[model samples]
Structure formats: structure tokens, C-alpha cells
Target: MHKEITIFNETILPGESKTIHMQIAKLHTMTDLQIPIIVERSKLDGPTVLFSAGLHGDEINGTEIVRQLIVQKINKPKRGTIICMPIINIFGFVNQTREFPDGRDLNRVFPGSKTGSLASRFAHYILQEIIPHVDYAIDFHAGGAQRFNAPQIRIVPNNQELKKLSDVFGAPFTLYSNHISGSFRTSCDHMGTKMLLFEGGKSLDMNQKVTDEAIEGSKRFLKHLKMLATKHQSMEAHATIYITKSDWIRANFSGMFHGLKAIGTFVKKGELLATISDPFGKIEHKVKAPHDGYLINVNDAPIVYQGDAIFHISKELE
Candidate 1:
């Protein structure tokens, strides 16, 4: 580890921890838009992990998780650096949106160009300043509008380090998905940084249970990485499922959705997961499971349109 590492032109030394008020852009009112960064470096050198959330401003569970870590001082990196960016998309966060002010999804325009949309500019800054120095990372997320995803870890295949971290994080389930081009994870991938996404709860709200699990999993990860002391005794023996395939049971007809199951429910093949009915209840469209599996997520919204995702079922592991 170098005595001093420069980030955003500000030099940070080992055995130091502070909030870096990095100015990334300016608001319309000429206010200085800043990205608040909390960097904690250990006295001894080890892996550098970044815990970032709120890439999509509306996804606030991640923001709350990072805030909890900071306020409680849970991130005691004994052997490495921890860069915590609780809210990267302050603009979108302020507006309670999933995209930038211009409606571009920040996450979909990663490793962005200096001269691009608000989302792209932010992404560009992050890539230029953050990803190069990170070894491992986790971006917290939650279900989008009108959706509630169960607490889970989402990752790409073939990343052993990410897989190990996901296992140690110990989310109730791990979902394997393909990498998206121009995503923050993909950008970090290009930089040889292993990053995983943690999904839970829903947007624009707080769930204490999910938050607790996220914090616990993060602590467990630190312990496994030898970056923090093990305050926990032996962990419980939970199966911690690895789901390889998942399908969304969408509505066959536009109507009101009545979910028959919630997160953590197991359904049998052809089981009725939900019922879609007209406002008058004149006609009902049954939404059934295609296969036996664990129901990981369910639509929180009562109203639905044809083709809307209502139930998310992960194929049963044989």
C-alpha cells in the first residue's frame, strides 16, 4: 500500500478515515453538487472493498444500509480500505427517481463519457476515481416500482471471488444472472474488480428485517475477508440457496392483481400464485406457477396490466 493514494485529486493516507466531499457537477441553481465519500483505510494493507448504493435514487434500501454502516461505525476495516458511497445519485435521490434528471438510468451508462447525460457524467466520474482502486465491491438494490424482492444476492457467473463473497454474505438466496454491458458491475469487471449486487425489499421504503440481514451479511463478509474481528459466534446452518434459473409469472390479462403468495413461499407446478381480476370482479385470470420452486418476489402493486410481472419463481434446485 502506498503512503498516499490520490482520489479526485485529494490524497488519502493509510490509517486514516474521513468523508471526502467530492464536487462532481453543479446544479441548475449553480450549487456545487458533491458526492459524499467515506473512506476508511486500515493500518495494515489488504483488499479494498467498496460499498456503494443508490445508483438508482429510488432504490433506497441500499442507501439506508450504507447509512447504518456509517452511523454505527460497523465498517472497521482492520486490514484494508473501505470506500462507502451511500448515495451516489443525489440528484435522482432528491427527486425520488430511478434515473437521472434527464431520465437516463445511471446504472445503464457506466464507464460513461465526460461529455454525456447527467447519469453518464456521474458514471464517468465514478469510473475515473473509484473503480480503479477497488478490489471487491457490492452494490445494494431493491425491487423497482410496485415490486418487493426477497433478500438475495445477485451475481454474474465465473467470478469466484464474488461467488465466495456472496456465499459468505449469506443472503437467503443467490441469483446468478448474465452481466449487462455498460453497467457499473460490468465497468468494474473491466477493471478486474469483483462486484456483486444485493437485492431486497422495495423502492422508496425501509424494511428493518432486510436491513438487518444486509448488515449482518456485510459483517460476516468482513470477518471472512479477515478485515474485521469475528464478533459473531459460529453462524447458523442455513441452506443459503443458489438459484440458477428464475421466471416471472406475468399477468395474462390486464386487471387487478391479487397475490396468493408472498416472499419465501414455495409453490408447486401449476399452482395458483395469483389471480388477476377486472375491477368489477366479473372475470378472473389465474396466474399459475410454471414449475415447482421458491417464490422469491411478488408484485406489491394491486393493479396490473397484461404482461406485467406478478410473481418471481426461482426454479427448484434438484
Candidate 2:
């Protein structure tokens, strides 16, 4: 039997479910905002998993994935516990921006201080109040600045456990990534919680394909932990490409950009990937693949500036 769990001064027993509204800081108008933390516990004892999204408010695709899990009753684990935080940065979500009203990226500040900024305090609360009971976590994210990423799972290289979990989750692409300083993944690593970062689509947009991929991968992940309910069947996972090295292709000249290649397609060296032309139609520049590799990310922006990263191509694969 699992012991009772406490969050926000509320106790949840085995087989019990609850939604806790956590209040941090208020808006300038003295209006209070609540971040909902939804918890579901099974009667049997097992690992505790957390599914979180919306670290960046504008990354609504992540939010949609988590919300669908609840709507689909996937959050009710067969055993152990499942905690969902569909929107982590409510402040950013309200304004439909990536950063907080104070202009701080919530993902960059981790295990924060109690006396710090609003974002920092929320960070501190999560690390202190919520993460201690979490045995595993999957944080969803989307590409920023109009860059569309293929569905992928990211983990720091060299961890066999995480690698195995990634294989079980079975995203279309698994990329080896180093932990960023003060990131939630890094903080979770410090707290001894294994975590997987799911990246797909682009900010301020929703793609059914991306969300479906995420939802299916998440079910696979839960089933691997033996937490998925019997009614929900995990789909057969496709072969995943493991990327160890990648580099971004930048725009050579500022112009109206057009992409010819699709995301997630393999490109041969010197293959024409896109073209950039001035609005005046006087000159056009061709964007070609530098080497033979898969295109993992492509900029969806109509305009590009010189040195703007427009494509992310794999340099090495495992």
C-alpha cells in the first residue's frame, strides 16, 4: 500500500483523485490567479509520474496534449499516481506570450528562491512542494520563434535508464541533448527524477499531427511504467531515429523566404531546400542542404533576416 501524498496542504489517499489550485502571485489589479494541479492515484502502489506542459505560455500545443490526456481519461493510471499540470505558467498563458509579464523565461529559472521574482518563487514551489514525490516526469514543449520541430524526445546523453525510457516512449525522433542550466529538466535531474522533454510543432500554433504523436507517445510511456489503464491500448511504436549531433542552417540574406523541403525528410548534400527572394523580385538565393542528414526543424516564418537559423539538420546519428 502506498502512503498518502500531500500537496498544497491537501492529502490524497490511494484511489483518490483531487484538483489543487495553487496560488502564487497576483496581478496588478489585485486579481488572484490559480494554477491547477490535477492528481489521480490508483488503488495499487507504484511509481509516481508527472505530466506537465506550458512551461512557456505560448506553447499551447503542449497544453493541448496534456489537456487531451485528461479529457481522454488517460490520466487515470492503473496503478501508482499520475499528476497533470496542463498549464504551468498561467501568467504567460493568459497573455499568450512565451515569457512572464516580468519578461522572464520560466524555464530558465529553476529551484528558485522564495524571495525571488514571481517566476522564481513558482519555480521554487514546484521544486520544493511537488517534485519530491515524483519518480518520473515528461515535460512537453514546442519550438519557438516560428521554428517547427518534428516530434522528438530529448534527453541528456549517457544515461542508460533515460535512453531505455526514450525507446519505450518511442517518439519519431530521439535527440541527445545536454541539460541547460536552471532548466526544469536539470532541476528534476538534481532531485533524482528521471525526465523526458518532448518537443514538437511551433509556438502559438496547434497541429493535430503533433498533438496526436505526443498523445500516443505519452500512452506508450505510461504503459511502460505499467500505469496505463487496461481500456487504453498503446499503439505499435515506429522506429525512432537517434540524433547525436545537429546544426542549424541560417539564412544568408534577409528576404522573403520560401521552404521547398518538408520537415523530417532526409536531404542529400547540396539538395535545394528552400529559396529566399527579395520582395522586389530582382534576385533570389537558393538554400541548400550542407550534408546528407534529416531535417528536424524548419522555420515557418515568411520573412528571414541574415544569419537567422532557418533549418536544423542532423550532423550525426546513432
Candidate 3:
């Protein structure tokens, strides 16, 4: 049997389930704001997996995925521990914004200082308290703003272990990315935790398809670690396309935007992808594909400004 685990000064025995309320700071109204951390541990010894979301408060799709995992009892592991933190940035989530009350992006602050900004202190708390016990983690995210991203997994290139895990999870697309300084993924990596960053849908919106993809992939990931419960049968997954290089397609004109191409579809060179026209119905401009590639991100906004990114296409694939 595995030994007992402690979080936030509360000890959880093997095979026990507990919800720890992490109270960092109070709201302006003098009310306590608690971040609920749900933990489930199996009596048998195994890996500890963390499924976290809502790092950006507006990215509700990720939060929905984690919530479904809990509702469906998928977080009840067969021989390991499962921890779910559905809303990391509860402050931003309440305000429907992407940043903290201080306007600092939580994603940009990692392994933070105890005596720093509110966001930084929270970051420090997470790394110090939760990350040490995590063996593998899947952090969910969605596109920032109005850009709709096709369901995808992102990992740093040249990591064979992560690449193998990505193959097991089987996201439709897996992109190679470098570690961003002060990002949670980077900090996790430094702490020797393997993590897969899942991105899909868009901020402040929820898509059923995106949620389904993330949940399926998560099940596959758990199964690979021999931690999935017997009741849930892991589904067969398609081979994920590995993207080595990509670039954003920017709008050439400022106007009311009309996109013609769907996300996750390939387009030929110079093919018409979208149209930008003046609101007055004069002087329309066509946005075409720079080359043949798969469109992974499509802007959903009705309006576009010149040089605004409208599409993100894979330029090189593996």
C-alpha cells in the first residue's frame, strides 16, 4: 500500500478521497476565496497524476473537461492518485478575464516568489505544495481571445518520453514547442514532472467536441500509466500528427471579416481562405493561403485589423 499523502496540512490516507480548500487571500468584500483541490488516491501504489485547468480564468473549456472527469468518476484511479484543480485562477474566472486582479498573466509567472504579487504568490504556493508529488500531469488550455484552436497537444521537442505519452494520448495534432520562461510547463519540467499541454476551443466559450477530445485523450493517458479504473474502457485513438513548424496568417486589410475555411482542414497554395471587406460594401480583400498546410487556429471574431493573426497553419510536419 502507498503511504499517506499530505496537502495543505491535511493528511489523506491511502484509498481515501478528500477535497482540500486552499485559501490564499480574501476578496475585497472581506469574504474568503477558497480554491478547491480534489484528490483521489487508490490503496495500491502507483503514479500520481494531476489534471489542472483554468490557468487563464476565461478558458472555460479546459475547466469543463476537468469537471467532466470528476462527474464521470474518471478521476477515481485504479492504483494511483488523481488530483483535479478545475480553476487555478479563480479571481480571473470570477471576472471573466485572462489575468489576475493585478492584470498579470498567471501563465507568465511560475516558480514564483512568496513575497511577490498575488498571482506570483499563488504560483509559488502551487509549485511548492502540489507539484512535488506529481509524476505526470496534463494541463488544459484554450486559445486566447477569439481564436478557435483545433484540439491539440503541445510538448517540447526531442523528449522521447513525452513523445511516447503523446502517442498514447492521441490528440488529433501534437505541436513541438519550446519551453517558455516562467511558464508552468517549464517549471514542471524543471521539477522532473512530465506534462502535456492540451489546447483547444477558445477562451470564455465551451465546445462539446473539444471537451470530448480532451477527455478521451486523458483516459488514454491514465490507462497508459495503469491508473484508469476498470469501469472506463479507454477508446482507440488515431495517430496524432506531429507539427514541427507553424506560422500565423495575418490579415492584410482592416474590415469586417468573413472566414471561408474550417479549422483542421488543409488548403492549397494561394487558395482563398477568407475575405475582408469594408463595412460600407466597397473594396474587398482576399486572404489566401501562403502555402499548402493544415489550418489549426481560426479567428472567430467578426472584425479584423490589418496584421491581426487570422489563421495558424502548420508549415512543417513529422
Candidate 4:
């Protein structure tokens, strides 16, 4: 049971482990910057799982999770291989932005063309060079700046195999999201691969709880896939909810916002979600939930404009 794995366009024979840097672009002074990737291939044949993060560039928590996983020589895969791409958008990462410098989102340019934009080229390379070699994948993400998300695993409902893998990841919540066009999940699905999207924490902010959960979840996923034989304590079983639709609660008046609820809090229709007050404290307005659901995301900052998103609700089951 032997297999060959490639890292940063370089191939490694079976039972080999290596690190390679994938060149992304050059700096203003022509300094070549590359994204580091690690590949670990075992002698025995098993499922190949790819762990990718930093797709949004500012989502540092996911990037750190991949870093820690690769640095530590913990329980190695007894059968399959693990391919890790810690930073997928190096350009945006340097600028602490969610999108590439070309003003394009790398995540939204999946299965892209080689002669397209910068984001499209990177997406195309990933789809052709890496995705085809993996059996399963985990794309990590966090809420952008000013937004906070409860740790959860989002999977396509119809993909039962991926849904089962999501359960084993053991996130506090499991969200059933449909496949969106041009998303990594959509591209991978087209190639007959299963990928799970794990969302948690806030951009550029390190949350220990989210990091711990992600690390534990990744290990659990390996065990469930029969890639790791080591056993550990299991995470608490949480209610897995399916959200058919979700929408944002926007502010109707421009003012300073005072959030009354936090991420992971359940809210009812017409519930007070926040309060908007003028700078002089003379005018105040109450923001309420439009429907009953869980508060998956909420604006963390106190300042907002009249159409700024204040909260995001995903309908929950009774």
C-alpha cells in the first residue's frame, strides 16, 4: 500500500514527507513571495485529506491551526496522507485583506481559467494540481473584521458522505449549506471530492476556544476516515441544525450600535437584537430580529451606518 503525493508542484514518492513553497507573486521590489505547503505520505494506502486555510487572508486563526498541525509530530496517519496549505492567498495575507490585490475573492474563483485574473489563476492551479489528488478536504474560515461567528461545520446536505464527515469533526454546530457556484466546495464536488467548510472566530483575532476546537476536530476527522488509529476523548455531542435560509439584520439608522446579543445566542422573532443611538444620545432606535433563529454572526464594533449589517440569523428547528 504505497502512494505518491505532490507538494507545491513537486512530487514525493511513497513513504516520503517534504515541504515546498509555492510561488505566488513578487513584491514591489521583485522579492518572490511564496505560500508554504507540507505533504506527509505514509507507506500504507488510505484516503488523502487536504487541510487548507487563509483563503480569506485575514482569517489568521485557521492559518495558525494548519501551522500547528504541521509543526507538531503528533499521531501520524497510519494509512493515508495529509496535504496542508497554510496560506492560500499570500498577496491578500500580506495586506490583511479578505480579497486579492486585484479586488477579487479567491474563494469565489474556483475551477478558474489560466488566462483569467490573478485570483482565477491561483484557483485554477489549485483545482488542477491539488484537488484531483485528494479524497477529502477541510477549508477553514473565520468571520471577517468586525464580525464574529460561532464555531460550526457547514456541509452540503445531499452529500451524505461529507455530512457524516462533518459530524465526526465534532464542531459545536453543523450547518447545511447549499453548494454555491464557484465556491471551493462546489468545484471539489464537481470532481467527486468531499469538502467541509468550518467557520469560527473573527478575522485577525486569535480565539483559543476556536483554535482548540479546530485542532481537535481535524484529528477526529482523521480517525473517522481510518487514517489515524490513535483514540482520544470525544467532543460533546451538540444539536446539528439545518438552515435552509439565512439573512442579515441591517441597521435602519446611522448611529452607534450597542449589541445586546452574542454569537451562538438563540433569538425569537421580534426580539431585541441591538440598539442604535445617535452620537448626542438624543435619538435611539431598537433593532429586533425579523424571524426566530440562532445568532450565528453579529457586528462586534459599536459604530455602524444606516444599512450596515448588525446581525445574521439562521432559522432553527423546534
Off by over 4 Å in 2: none
* lDDT at residue 105 of model 4 (Cα atoms): 89
Candidate 2 lDDT tens digits, 1-318: 347889989999999999999998888899999999999999998999999999999999999999999999999999999999999999999999999887889999997889998889999999988999899999999999899999999999999999999998888899999999989999999999999999999999999999999999999999998999999988988888999999999999999999998999999999999999999989999999999999999999999999999999999999
User: What lDDT tens digits, residue by residue, belong to model 3 across residues 143-175?
Assistant: 998999999999999999999999999999999
For all predicted structures, in order, the TM-scores are 0.95, 0.99, 0.99, 0.93
Q: Which run of 10 residues does model 4 get worst, by summed lDDT?
A: 230-239
In model 4, the clashing pairs are none
Model 2 Cα displacement at 86 (Å)? 0.5
Model 3 is weakest, by summed lDDT over 10 consecutive residues, at 1-10
Quantify all predictions' global Cα lDDT against the true fold.
0.85, 0.94, 0.95, 0.82
Ranking by lDDT: 3, 2, 1, 4
lDDT of 1 by residue, 1-318 (tens): 545667888878888887888776788899887879899988898888899999999999999999988777766587888889999999988889998888898889988989988788889989998888888888899899988989999888677777788888899889998889889988988898888789999999889988988888888777777876444432542557888888888878998888888797888998888888888858988888899999888898989988888888887452
User: What are the runs in model 4 whose C-alpha is more than 4 Å off?
Assistant: 7-9, 229-237, 316-318
Off by over 4 Å in 3: none
